[model samples]
Target chain A: MTETAGTYGTEFFVRWLEAVAEAVEREADRLTELDAAIGDADHGANLRRGFTAVRKALEEEPPTAPGAVLVAAGKQLISTVGGASGPLYGTLLRRAGKALGDDPQVTRERFAGALGEGVEAVSRLGGAAPGDKTMLDALGPGVEGLKVSFSAGRDRAGEGAAGTVPLRARKGRASYLGERSAGHEDPGAASSALLFAALAATARAEAADGTRTDGEGAA
Target chain B: MSAGRDDDGRGGGGMSAGRVGIVLVSHSAGVAAAVAELARGLAGGGDTAPVRPAGGTPGGGLGTSAELIAEAARAVDGGAGVALLVDLGSAVLTVKALLAEGGELPEGARLVDAPFVEGAVAAVVTASAGAGLDEVAAAASEAYTYRKE
Candidate 1:
């Protein structure tokens, strides 16, 4: 059977997680550097440790449903990450996963709506809004653009991350810095943009692969 | 470490019944244990409430661990509810997350909003006096209004 575009299954979610782990590994130092300017310098290290744990968990159990995949990943993040990002990102995934329910395959629109709920959960958890120089800056816009397309979501999230460069933080550890928080992009927002990028890349890769059976590459 | 073992042993017993427990959460293992010791000392000797420290990462780094927090909460919980006093930042967030998630702790476990050291001291002292969860929490919260002048 051929899986069409705009619909994702458990494998796609798994690949997306894999892509995120790789991207986070590659960009950890950069994220930590940005964090050092406005917040603690442990953002990169914390996320790297969290994602590494997430990767290990996926390898160990490998949930069959997309929602289960996300829920499991979120739980690992909450249990392991040891920073604000842990609960924030963990809530994002856990809420989105719960929204997805047990659906084995989800349309892009359904996924977008679920992701929007996840972003809202993050906002509620952190008590921050779009201009607060938090992950919501990227995540809120990204979910909006996700309603349109994966690429659009990726682009909007990236733009929102960059847009944090000039904003003073109004929440989290950075808020303590007051005026000194400006001129540095929020590390959480930067990592959030990477999430969208991974989603877009996974969708693109799926499209390029075209009409493959689930058992074709089972290893 | 010896204190931890002793606390665990005493906590395993139900002789100190009807007292609220206290858990101190901090980013540093040394800080959490030291504060727990101070609070216990300040609470005085005979029949003091169970006070445990849940601090540092599972790998023993400078960060809070939800798993450790949950374990400590369980360790300190008596028939009365547990009151958790946190040091800073992630400690607060981690406790909130655990509470929001539910089922990870005993029923009625609460995060008391107060200064770390002072709040722990107040909470332990009040709990040792057989105060309920709310009274212990209130005592800790009242620590915020303390005047050093």
Candidate 2:
């Protein structure tokens, strides 16, 4: 079938969910490793549980719309996980889901904008600035990077993840570390980068399969 | 990565056909028990999916003993697979050790790092929905990494 515009079908969104789950599973250890340095060292473990729940929910009742999938995932995160990251991260997904609003397919521009909204929600909830050395340190720039890469016809999720270094944490557990958090990358940021990377990878794969249409209507 | 058939033989999302179970491990048995209670509450009158809580045994060793965790893992892996979730620090280490000693993890078996609140909520929700262990595990992990916008 000829790929439509920026919109993705249920299958595509499901793939996105799966990719996210896999990414979290693979990197859970790394996240905990980072958190251990400054915070309680449970970021990895906490996230692993949340995503596992999301995946299970999806399996039971797969949503038809991309937004619904995200919304459901967000709800699962908020209810199943605990700790500061739970609410912060849950709010982000919930916000993204709201922004998506039942759209079955999302264009590159639209998805990027929605993600930006999600990031903004996280910033507001956490009360952290760009260089606060929290997940935002990575996500703020990661979202910006996605915008830029999408616009430039390039994918730079990895680049954004790499940029989280040299920042001081202003909120969350890491914030307590003061200047100590400056040098180390934020665990949240690293994970956020994975999210974007998964998105980019999904889009690219679809595009390669000729399942994605290019240009205006694709939005 | 097969999305195996559900109980009805219908190919839903990636749900497996085998029976599903839960394995909860925490530093304190109280914590694990609390999680189980929450799961039961959320489960309502629906199918009673097996939820094995480890680590909080009454003995003096630790809240959750390594042996208890291994047993829980084994129970979950009997059929479709088991989903493992734990609290912070040593609790996590304890569960990992149990998994290592528990022999091969079922095809769909997995360990989730979800926070106490979110992870429990997610697991309960998934169980109530009749989701398989693998699916529930995926949700727990996703919830952990989610950020609000």
Please name the candidate that would achieve the greatest TM-score relative to the true structure. 1
- Candidate 1 lDDT, B1-64, residue by residue in tens: 2244345444666755567889999999999999999988888856789899998998988888
Global CA lDDT computed for model 1 = 0.86
Chain B global fold similarity (TM-score) for predicted model 1 against the true chain B: 0.89
Model 2 stretches astray by more than 4 angstroms: A148-157, A211-219, B1-149
Q: Give me candidate 2's TM-score against the actual structure.
A: 0.56
Q: Residues B14-98, candidate 2: write the lDDT tens digits.
A: 2322456677877677778788888767667345566778745435333345456655655544356667787764455444433
Q: Residue B83 lDDT in model 2?
A: 77
Which ten residues in a row are the worst by lDDT in model 1 chain B? B1-10
> Would you give the TM-score of chain B in model 2?
0.70
DockQ scores for all the models shown?
Answer: 0.62, 0.03
Per-residue lDDT of A114-153 in model 2, one digit per residue for the tens? 8789888777655677766666766666667666654232
- RMSD for all candidates, in order, please: 3.7, 14.2
Best by lDDT: 1
